[model samples]
Target: MRSLARCCARNERRRHDCKEYRRAVVTYYLGIDAGGSHCRCRLVDSDRQVIGQGESGPANARIGVEALKATLMFACNQAIAQAGLSEGDVARIDAGFGIAGIGRPGIKEQLAQLDFPFRSVRYETDAFIANLGAHQGADGAILVIGTGSIAHVRVDGRSFSIGGYGFPISDEGSGAALGLSAMRHALRALDGRTKPTPLSAAVTGRFDHDTTLAVAWMDQATPRDYASFAPLVMDYADAGDSIARSIVEDAALHVERFIEAVFERGAPRCALAGGLSHRMRPWLRQKTVERLVEPLGDPLDGALLLAGSP
Candidate 1:
């Protein structure tokens, strides 16, 4: 149940009838879509209007389990309050948790340790929800390239994914990876180890003209910090920085590998989502488009739909 301290005194919105029976039920659904930098919880009726919403901080597994629980609790409680519902009412509500941290070791165990008040719980990697949200229960694949990256294909409710492992060693074409590449280039330039580019200037200027400054920043910075610099890669690339352009091009290639993996599963349609989704679009290879997709809905909305459906 988390905490009722976040509850509201009045209902936020009215419920609607389920089309199947021509009967209006008081039931509602809750959806929590968590990320590396922010978490959002949405409440909706069977009809899928966003009746209530709440947001909190990052829930990435790399943040550790304690932080994950805290963030989920905070956002979920806010959503309960916003929906004008109480802890007890949630016992009848179905909830779907599409979280960034789910695929990590000990994640399922840690989540089971928590005591959320949902009547039922369906947990999955953020990538699955991203695909469902984008595909709307149809058979298709979705690539989510945010702080991390994963690609998933959905056929009738079953899902399969590729490459959502983590940073440096995995998660190709992700924001974290992009930033790491940018930083590598920045360091090389600073150490007189490589040719000059605006990226060096940008990185140096961003950190007060000292690449060493990033060491301390990195110590405090989560994956989000690395992902944050992903834009810098694009910025430099747009300005004709050869290294930056190369990074983006290489990233596009990495991203395609995931698409290819999904296509290998016989996926016919595909869509892209997350921070890097649109950014990588212009650079996407022609074959990737041969397996294109039109998104079904936003992830938050998809969460609500999953919760509401029987």
Candidate 2:
């Protein structure tokens, strides 16, 4: 009986030690979704349980590497603090980032050189992560119309994309695009080249009807700056303003084209995502509207998947 008791005690000790070992070896992951307007971070444990969340300002790569880094770190530090973790724990965390402008030339290379506090780090375009989250890593496509626009599809382990070149060049269905259209119409109205509708008058009113002031604002405007006008355009459209309706309808046509292109690439499913998606949906053709699916997850979830968190 004494020998049996000893064996049972030893076995219990072994089990306790094993539990401690497992706890000590558990990993943590940080997922970041950085866009033209905001930076968001999520922290999770190895079991895929949320530890904390944080958000900060824009982290667009075009904003300059130092500023981008500052934005990212500010959000990350908040998440770490919320998780009750110290800065030292950063060295043990794996990180995944889905950032706007990452696909631009030299941006990825510049980011790769940063000394981030993580055990591992990976980067991908925001559109790619949105698609991954939308479909839960399954084969699918996503059309993102936010401050910028992009179409991305993944099929059979391969990825293809359309649009999202950037503001002024591409992003056809984006908020910035709508704002740009409004600005042009407003300018035309100011020059007496077009009839000044409520939309045009409202746009011009922002500059106090001064074309010179409008031009000066344009000279310093970034995509986010232009996107600020999108809500006003959308509001005017809903109120039956002809110029606003025209601008929205034109942008919707671009959205339709992007959706068709994604389907043409053999994506079995497609989702419309981003801040402007909800507003844009009501403007889409019925047939196009019927085809979009609700996303299964969000970009932060996709970023976590990229981090290889269990």
Candidate 3:
């Protein structure tokens, strides 16, 4: 009878251990692509099946660490809720974050203090994630043109970045740059230093042709504020405005230069990924255009990969 009791006890202990093992093995994955304009999150199971997704406000590191954390938390909670997971489940998740301005001094250290309810976490720059996803982790290059511009390339396990400096002094082939140029042209036209076309007239109309008011607005304008006028430049260019066309063409040259530099560094493939990518495609040289390939995925996908990294 004692022997039978010992066998039953052993069976019970084995069952308990099995249950604990299963619980410990179950894992969830979260990927966050945190950009200047918005933060997006994706939750997936161990099998790589998406369970939920969410979005929130800007999480740019330049916006201040607290603000970035708030936006990231908002996105994370929404996704977790949508996945129908309990609060405790958050602690079982592994997460990866791809954030804009992460390369800025002290930003990485600042992110370390963020309270993420995950089993583990990884962080990478937005440009790296974009390039990673575009090529699906293979060696390649990506030129990202949005409110700002940056080029990233990976080749033979090494990474290189070019032209990611913020607006005014850099970010030459970016929406902010294009828009700023348009505003400058408008100012010149107002002073009779340049011929006023439909583009200049429309831009000047926003300030009632008052150079003083325009200058005042610009004095405190953020990059997003300047980028808001990019569509106007593109519209005017499409309408055959000479000044607008010149501005766009100039921007295209800068983009081409980025591509050439990337290829010279031995990247076997290249892609354009960002809000302005498709819009600028038509203006690229046929030879340059031919070298481009469709991105395999996006930054969010790259962020997911980071979650699985050691």
| lDDT of candidate 1 at residue 50, scale 0 to 100 | 66
**Candidate 2 at 62: error in angstroms?**
1.0
TM-score of each: 0.86, 0.92, 0.90
Q: How many clashes in each structure?
A: 1, 0, 0
Count of clashes in candidate 3: 0
For residues 164-259, could you state the per-residue lDDT of candidate 3 as single tens digits?
A: 877778888788899899999999999999999999999999999999999999999888788888888988898899999999999999999999
Candidate 1's residue-wise lDDT over 1-310, tens digit each?
3345334312222222234233334577888888876888888766666677889988876777777878987988887787776555677678888888687778888887777677777777777777777867678888888888888888655678787777768888989888888888887887889987888778767788686787778778767889888888888888889889988999999988888788788787878889778888888877676677768787876676566553
How many collisions between residues are there in candidate 1?
Answer: 1
Q: List the residue pairs that clash in candidate 2.
A: none
Candidate 3 Cα errors over 4 Å, as ranges: 1-24
How far off is residue 230 in model 2, in Å?
A: 0.6
Show the lowest summed lDDT stretch of 10 residues, model 1.
8-17
Worst 10 residues of 2 by lDDT: 83-92
- What is each predicted model's overall lDDT from 0 to 1? 0.78, 0.92, 0.88
